[model samples]
Target chain A: MNLLQKFCTRINLTKSSKGYNVSVIALLIILLLIGIFLSISIGSSKISLADIVSAIRLKDQGSNNYRIISFVRIPRTIAAVLVGCALAVSGAILQSVLNNSLASPNVIGVNSGAGLFFILTAAFFPVNIYLSTIAAFIGAILAVFLVYFIARKTGASRMAIVLSGVAVSSFIGAITDTVLTLKPDTMIARAAFLIGGFSGITMDKLSFAGVFILIALIASLVLSYDMNVLALGDESAKSLGLNISRIRFSSLILAAILAGSAISFAGHIGFVGLIVPHVARFIVGHDNRLVIPVSALMGSIFTLLCDLLARVLFAPYEIPVGIIMSFLGGPFFIYLLVKGRRGQLYD
Target chain B: MIKLEDISSGYNKITIIKDINISFNQGTITSIIGKNGCGKTTLLRTASNLLKPFSGKISVADKPITDYSDKELARKVSFLPQLRSVPNITVYNLVMHGRYPYLGFSRTPQKHDKEIVDRAIEEMNLASYVNKNIQELSGGQRQKVYIAMVLAQNSDIIFLDEPTTYLDINHQLEILQIVKRLKQMGKTIIMVLHDLSNALSYSDNICLMEKGQIAIYDSPEGVYKSGKIEEIFNVCSQQLAVADGTKQYVFYIE
Candidate 1:
């Protein structure tokens, strides 16, 4: 009887601790560090942890392991972490602002929007990295605005945003297909860009989007409290002195910047944005104050692990990280939908 | 004190309440009572400044509502609408949000804000449910939690749209008792009520509406004596003296 009581107490402790923000964040941060370490060390040519430490310490510019770490592994690992953080936080903001669990950067046409514009910039412009990032950001903002205006104009219902997003996504997809078919040689690495991998990611390519993601992440954190109030519905938020339109607009813009910058380098990486926020909410409940940071951290861990799997799963030949994400995320999302049928997923 | 002069407003371009002129005295409980589609809610919403009037001016505490910033107006007046989302939140967290107007940009609740929330929770008999998710609460309990949140706002003027709607008999009386307590604390309380007897017996004044205008705004007794309530509601009313020496009103269709 005493052992049963102890076992029940253990279960209760785990349940309650999952809802605590600090502990969850700490655990995720630890997991993220481990993920980063594993991603850097466990490549085709295995570099040990001690070698990684010595590589950083010795600053050996000539050694092969040092060259691999500095040129390839470091940039790839950082790209995965930043992309994860960006998409996850973007999805978190979209979910709260739209008040729909299904809303995500990829689902709502944000990632595809960025992808189309990046491809357009590459085709039309001189393939400037900065210009492509800006174009992608512009596309993301436009897509979100289009989705929002349609949803609002039609009397914003819970499902209206998602429905309009689907419509807009398919329309954009058609345009993208036309562009690709017509200008077949416009983008040389078309499949890699569409499928989203970090194979040729360099420090230069990651630089612009890296800064964009960091700034937007900080802005989301600063406005997280207002986001919490905004989740209380427009009338209540206004009654509590929140400028409803301003907060909502700001959240949308922030989400756009995050998603756009991420897609600029990572291509149309799907499901990380969609799934990470849900996982974060499941851990921390619904406060954006905790949800934003938790989502950002968990996103980095998830993407890092996925990217590592993409690298080592087939050894020598690599698959796009997006494929692995869809493989895992598609089933998980269906499970969420099925479980939510009784109103368990959302409340 | 809140005064609305020549206020005309509605959704989009269509006006629901037109040329409404009314005033709510400080430290008094005023109930706006009317049938469906009679613009009682429109008037309450307009007076609270939730619905921006298309034409006229609304003044709270002798200053134009537009003159005050959103937070400043929130500090002076708090409005609770008929429909509210049941967000997945805890009782404590929901009540703490009432301090939004007073919070700095960081929005971290200070010691004073927590104390205010605690007092409001205690007043609503929600001290025991502070950590519980609001979704787990019953309807009456949820209503009390919302009222507790409003109480935590600590505003001078409070607007409630049908505060007693969907509540049972005992909870209805309980909410009214809390309203009375709020009035006694020197807060101006304005609400829309569907229960004629409760409105008539509890409110200091009753603003009766017909169509899109105020039929009469007078003391409860004066409005009752004027026979406008009976004529407008299409019901017969009798004033009976209760055992406690207070008056009770019963309404029935003749």
Candidate 2:
């Protein structure tokens, strides 16, 4: 048994040290599965579990339900999971590396940076999602460097980093706004950036973002041990022979890729990245390996459920999933800040 | 043994300490004493490869410090920087981090690593609070947890910067006594200390700093006999042999 397992064993007395409380993870997965099953079945057109079963079994070759399930609901559901996993895992990485609870792609200007560049790409190259995503990747990287450039100049105070983020975010927002006002024909890009939704997802876009999110997720899992060292603070970790700069740089890149792609597909989804990692830390107790994976699972599950609620709340008149997430995530984030004083829901 | 060959170190192209030359003896407790900002901490940091020297070179056991990778350097030396954050983690988890050099990603601490952490915690007398979050501990207790982490590292040499700063009198004594015990266990110990009395009583050697230079480097008695200690510190010091055979230096502002 590993040392962390022994540490975990104190809390979970019935389980052996070799297993570090995967029961919670198992429960989250089950919840996600149930949410997925419900999302596919009880949408605008109610297809029963039997229809879903027969469709999966391939027995019902001529069913309309099969066509809707295969093309529409499945792609939409997959998009929600991918975006959630991306944002949450990325947020977890940022919080640890930056040593600040409030560090997320949205809060740190990465999403806004991605959004700005994406609009520029859409303006220049119409309806080209591939160019827009590539533009997002570049912009996200540039934005992180801008934040770092600001922080490095002033010796990187925690409050100073946040202030730098605010500056960069505002700058990115103003530029995006100016671009939109100058050229109104770029409303297609505006539609994607302004109202974050998953209304009409195609297999191609899903696969495009899915590959990046999957690779980013795996990369984060591999670097999870380094993230744990970082929580002890840079000087101490450096003393332990960790190259703090290299670790910090690479982790930020991974987080950017995750957030940039999420924003590339869905319009500035605010709170998933900020909130999920905090929830995961509360559940798994600050081991980033556990926290990273838990955050990904929990994020996917929560977004899937929220997306479900967004669609079904008022039949035929659907609100954006981003709206539901903001409603849920904003209040909870504020609560975390208040409870942060009381030593809860924060690392 | 660690040797510093006229090393100069600082941040952002600015040299804080210039042209420092010293070689540390093996199995000795060497306490560096100086005025605030005299570069004692900087020297300690640079010697341990935490800060790159602007000039000169440092070698540990005949190998240039730059030759070692981070993990290899970690195996040879452990450093406890000034305490700031109380990392929102338990004592057990914190100590387990000391095994970083040995374990990579996805490898959990085995029985061997667990025993090392347990022994280090026991040595620091923090076994009772092993499960407690670091923030929940007292200042001295938290400091001990950090020390426990370095002890678990099991390196040949250890560097501690102001290890007893911001501690109560009793806690200071307890921490210094622990350092003496560590020296007895045959680990090379180098530390930046503000307490001259503790340095005089507990350490085998003292390096006194003045204006970012090593003004005096000698045994406690030798440095005391040089008459520079009084001028540098601006205090009159008297020696008193206590209940133990070791003599204590008491300083009073003149």
Candidate 3:
């Protein structure tokens, strides 16, 4: 047999998965770096490898290439990566903590929560990045808590949580729409925010949300081990001495921080949370320790690639990255359903 | 090793198990047997700290159970809940989670933890299935995997709620054998069992419940002599000698 076949058979023979998991993660990290390079270089302005290197080094700050890379593309690229990492990790955590595969930041009303609050903040308050970020975080928390409490009150089954999330999401979405209808002045900002694109992104907008997302991502890695236990069900988790409520609450808060912060800057970017984690699990199996970091890296790469496609797919007219995401995510989701692996994976 | 006093616990406001007081001795197998909804599961859950008693005091190792942290309590007792999702994890990984309470902040499995997991997998005869996804396993095999996880916990007290439920006769016997071996290892075993004959055959003591109250807590012989099985279950009981030279209680509906 060839070496690849030998390795595949070995993997099936019940060997330690750490070896394969580590290799998979390392490979993804390398791919992510390549993806970032591609995202930076392949924009409408056609910034080359040499230009990106020089721009990042500030070797020729006055050059037009440096100006485009530094001011526009750099901030946009970083925002894509951060937003991707945050949403994907948040979805992974929510899926495990809620023990439902359907649980995602978008599916569970967390994104709409942040979106609603961001809209309200943008309308009433001055355009303060910090205030909007915090408001979005609080809004995400409020929405998640609402969904949780509603589900709990109505029998906290797995389906109940998802059903409650749908109910809460539409309600929050309607509120946001109504707010936009009342204040036509906010439509310009709300339009781009709703579609979710990298156009006009700035370092100032990403700064606060970036910090929150980084801290929340680190916290998620720390808590991933406990999350594995939590996925075993409440009774098993509690029996293993896990504080089920504490872990679940902390996980939700971290997820909120992630989804909330990302949407605070990136707008209601959908499908990254819902799709990337499933893909990550497909690659790395179900260990959250492996799933979380893999999701983070894969999320960054997925968004970066999607953003790249959005930039070049139409030469003069740039579409919102969220539109491209829906175009891809809708088909991928149906593919997962057609594969019939969902039951085997989540059961 | 575990004690409960004036325990009343249930879902929401309604009390299912009321005014129960019982203690489990170490190095023995005690099976809780009762009709459905008689709160046998609740009593087991309450004692294991999975369900908080509405009003009661529980002590473990002569100290209040509340005094111990969750990790400490986990190290003291391992519980196999009746309801659990079949997580999409390999057998080895799932069994390793039994060492959660023993790990430090890093949560990495040390050599000691690995050795225990190895022994547990070996004990459960799960060596061949270590790398297989638990979802791929049969009902009996999955039950073995879960039991291996509990064994890897290595707690002084073990709580299993219907460990043999839904398994075929062969697998059920195998699980009972493991429980027997656990008692031989000097660990306390508390389980809720629906099979009266199996409980009588396997456990040193049987706690019979009726209407959420402990009707009898005694040796299997004593419980059988009390004629409570026939009275409560509306069944006839016969003591027969098996080829193994042990008396087995067989229950049949009249």
Candidate 4:
């Protein structure tokens, strides 16, 4: 192992994490940067590194390369990285908070909640990004709280969380379908919104969602220690001076803000949140301090890779990145469920 | 000192410990002894502010415990629950978490905090295992690491629920001896123990509990003389003097 890798494994006696063990984190950052460059340069209208560099540097203003880089590739790449980061960090938070590996936003109705609300926004409001973002945030929080309430009422056991999550997801799915059926005109506009994609993303919406997500990610880092304590179960955590309910509620809100913003901007992307966090944990261990940042970078890297596959794999017959995620994430999600039930995955 | 007045504490809106009114004297080791499901753990939890009493007030150091910020209460009182989900973490990491209540928004323990954690690890005799993963240790060692965590919190009062449960007899006696050390340092320690013999031998006062109520609060000899031990445990007790001349209760269930 290199210095950074050795640094990654260095133990810090002051915090719950093993320290900022940078090997995996540094690797993920490098991987994400490579993915970003590829996502920009290897599209259908391929631009060379130098030309893309000039375009990014604004030296070739209004040129074909410039238009491709600025109008299409840059925004799409940004959306992919930010949306990936947002979803994965929040997913990591929810898993730690609920003390279950299966507690991702998509698995726990957050995506469906935000998706339904986004559809409602499209149907009721004019095609307004700001209104839709707000709607999605509210919807995600509502879904999370509903799942939490159901879990609490049903004994709040680890299994209850996932079970209630599925129930709420199905219920929200039914509502979203009904709204779509009742208003067919909104369907055309929200067609891309339903199945998540990074294509046609604008710099404006990306920046808006990006700010909130970056803030949430930082907050997750700050709250990571409490999250680690919470992983020890409620009684012990509470005995050690953690206000379990307060931390749970705050983390729920933070997770909602993250997933909701991603859904608002990228359109209900699934599996990135669930899969990326697990991947990061495999490398970084269960410490949320490492898990949160590593997962963010890993999420960005994975989704950017997926978006590249989605966009150019079929030569102009572009599929939404979310579909690709579901295809890849679906079986992995199943494996997680099966393995998690058998006590193979860390909770 | 911690005082509980008319405390009725439990889970999910139902009371498991009812109308508990007791004050744990300052700088002494007090053990609450009871049978299984007798609410000893619940009482400890309530007194330490882990469980909110359904009706009553709890005062620590002459102030309502509820009035103190969670961190403030934690700085004064530390509690170690009986059951905890052991995470895949190192002993140092687990014990360092005890410094969390003292940590700021950054949540990083400072140099002084590291010293405290190191002292705790040293005191627990876990210096060799501090770097090892928690799962690598035996059950008794894990319990000691947990106890070290509460000790590292460096609170004025510490509550341990069955601190000796998983230990061997020697280690159990060692922990009870550590309790004596804690008391000598002027720290009040409250513990819930199922072992009546250990409680009688180690504790300054034994609060005999039956069901959810305190049967009697007295020294080992006083509780034995109160005759509630026989009534509560269905055990006849005879006083026997140990080599140290301290009276010991020998009880046999009829």
| Interface C-alpha root-mean-square deviation, candidates in order | 0.8, 1.4, 1.0, 1.4
**Candidate order by decreasing lDDT:** 3, 1, 2, 4
What level of docking quality does candidate 4 show? medium
DockQ of each two-chain model: 0.82, 0.70, 0.81, 0.67
TM-score of 1: 0.93
Per-residue CA lDDT of model 2 for B138-242, tens digit only, reads: 999988989888888889899999999999999999999889888888899999988899888888999999988999999999999897899998999999988
What candidate 2 gets wrong by more than 4 Å, as runs, is A1-20, A58-61, A145-164, A332-341
lDDT string for model 1 (A27-86, tens) is 788999999999999989999887788787867678999988988999999999999999
| TM-scores for candidates 1 onward, in order | 0.93, 0.93, 0.94, 0.90
Higher-ranked by TM-score: 2 or 4: 2
Model 1 lDDT per residue over B208-252, tens place: 988888899999999999999888888999999999999999999
lDDT of 2 by residue, A159-195 (tens): 6667888999999989999998987877777776778
Native contacts recovered, in order, as a fraction for each?
A: 0.84, 0.70, 0.84, 0.68
Indicate the docking level reached by candidate 2. medium
**CA-lDDT, candidates in order:** 0.85, 0.84, 0.86, 0.82
* Winner on DockQ (2 vs 4): 2
Model 3 TM-score relative to the real fold: 0.94
The residue pairs found clashing in candidate 4 are A8-A21, A8-A22
Interface RMSD of 3: 1.0
Instruction: Name the runs in model 3 displaced over 4 angstroms.
Output: A1-16, A126-134, A148-164, A336-347
